[model samples]
Target: MTQLETAMAILMKVFDQYAAADGKTSSLSKAEVKTLLEKELPQLIKQAKNKEDVDKLIKSLDFNGDAEVDFEEFVVLVAALTCSCHGRQGKK
Candidate 1:
């Protein structure tokens, strides 16, 4: 697969890996999102200036107000994070 394809696959796999905790394959609950962040994104979590930032971030990602993040929502989070990271790297 191409690099973008591989990245997309990895995203799905990671989301699935975390989403399985709640027995729902379609979306992630608050607890699942917390776990995914704490486990898969320890570094980013650490970068958060305050603990509430994590909660706020998750809340913001729930664009549909469904209280769960679907695959499309997850992709938006990933894309935003990627853009933020890319922007930071370009500064150095």
Candidate 2:
């Protein structure tokens, strides 16, 4: 697979791995999201000034007002973070 395809596959796999924690494969619960971030995105979590920042991030990712985050919402978070990081790279 191409690099982009591999990345996409990895994203799906990671989401599925975390989302399955509560026997729900379609979405991620708040706790699952937190664990995913803590374990998968440790750098981002470390950059968070406090727990509230992480809480706010998880809340914001829930676009449908549902307590859980679906795959679309998860992709948006990843895309936004990618854009932010890419923009920073351009500046450097």
Highest TM-score: give the candidate number.
2
TM-score per prediction, in order, is: 0.90, 0.93
Please list the residue runs of candidate 2 whose C-alpha ends up more than 4 Å from where it truly belongs after superposition.
88-92
Off-target runs (Cα >4 Å) in candidate 1 are 88-92
Candidate 2 lDDT by residue in tens digits, 1-92: 99999999999999999999999999999999999999999999999999999999999999999899999999999998998988863454
In candidate 2, residue 87 scores what lDDT?
Answer: 82
Q: Best-fitting candidate, measured by lDDT?
A: 2
Write model 1 residue lDDT over 1-92, tens digit each, in one string: 99999998999999998889889989999999999999988998999999799999999989999999999999998988887877863454
Ten-residue region with minimum lDDT total, candidate 2: 83-92
Model 2 has a clash total of 0
Candidate 1 structure, TM-score to reference: 0.90
